[model samples]
Target: MKHILALLFLTAASVMANTAHAENIGCVSTTWRVVNNDKVCVQSFKDPDIEGVACHVSYAQTGGISGALGFAEDPSRFSISCRQAGPIVAKKPIPKKQEEVFTQRMSFLFKGLNVSRLVDTENNSLVYLIVSEKVIEGSPFNSISTVPLMPWGTQAPQFQLK
Candidate 1:
């Protein structure tokens, strides 16, 4: 059917878009269970709109029967680290305030992990933060890391923060 094909195309497009932003770099086993093994997943991603900057996030992933069934919510705690991987360059005007850079579903519904980027114009730095959100409420737990923009080579392009 036309509707079914459209739906499939949209679903595939969304999945591809998410993958373009981030990739699972590593995962570590945490708790053991009869149904499945718990894990802490680590992912590396680049700022979708920025060049020469990358970030890593590590978070606890639920396990066991519920998790295996995609019915579990991951923990709210996570860590983030952002660094200047090369000559920092902003492809577009970056806001001085916080902006959501990346997000991943923590549960099947109503729960997610998000990473935000903040531009520090005065310090010539970028701050990345990780937090958890729920449909009804959000967690106060968060982690942040910073990267200072500096010349990597002679041709380091100017980064603009508006």
Candidate 2:
């Protein structure tokens, strides 16, 4: 009986810890706004994998109860901009082409916003693509930002093949 109780306690604690970690890393409410007759708010969060970079994500709210249901019905429309608030040190080199580093649900019905880090080899800069869309439905809007690496330092990693 004691073993069973210990197992149950450990499982519960792990579950709670996972939930807390997810909430901390993904989305956290930041600001609120009034648009038209509805209240529009922006929830800003940073990418867990990338340091010194912050993304400000803003979205409009649809009228409903104050819970998950309400947010689900809300439109998936969103805007994002990633800026280097501090010195960006690449612990691991980022790859060229499109790669989704972070993703979160903006609304129900298969709607989500994804943040991808792309390497601009030609320009020697970093590009971030913010895409918002529904699963079955397509998106007509997207945004991007390019941060040029300072000439003094911050050069892309060089890989030599054997």
Candidate 3:
């Protein structure tokens, strides 16, 4: 039964596309399993639409028979931190409202991890929020990070959202 479920999730993975592509930074094992080890992992991704900003997220990854086959539902246990890696620059149009910038699957179908960016015009900052979403239920597990658009060595770029 678990194998059947795992197969279904793997099939769905082929069809469902994740908007963000993250590079694994590292992982630390938490529990020992026969096939694999349950671990906490950190992954980093750059904002595709925006330049000079990068985010690193960490979350728990399940292990064991089910997890090894990519069938287990990962917990909505994650945190995010985004920073200005270089001089701030808006590569595309800045939206006035909150915009989803990244997404990763957390479960078979109904659950996912999402990241969004909001331009804080009043504060002259960019706020990034990460949330866990499920189709049938709401999750309170979420995190946020902010980056202030300031001068990097002599270049100060102020932004206006459209």
Listed in order, each prediction's TM-score against the native is 0.85, 0.61, 0.85
Q: What are the lDDT figures for the candidates, one per model?
A: 0.82, 0.56, 0.83
lDDT of 3 by residue, 28-59 (tens): 99999889899999999988766788999998
**For model 2, what is the alpha-carbon lDDT of residue 132?**
72
> lDDT order of candidates, best first?
3, 1, 2
Cα lDDT tens digits for candidate 2, 1-162 = 799767855754453333212223233343432422344465555545445666665665554344334444555566666676666655455556666755655554256566677777778667777777564785777777776654324644332111
Q: Which is the leading candidate under TM-score?
A: 3
Model 3: what TM-score?
0.85
Candidate that beats the other on lDDT, 2 or 3, i.e. the better one: 3
Full ranking by TM-score: 3, 1, 2
Weakest 10 consecutive residues of candidate 3 by summed lDDT: 11-20
Which residue runs of candidate 1 sit more than 4 Å off their true CA positions? 1-20
Clash counts per candidate, in order, are: 0, 0, 0
**Global local distance difference test of model 2:** 0.56
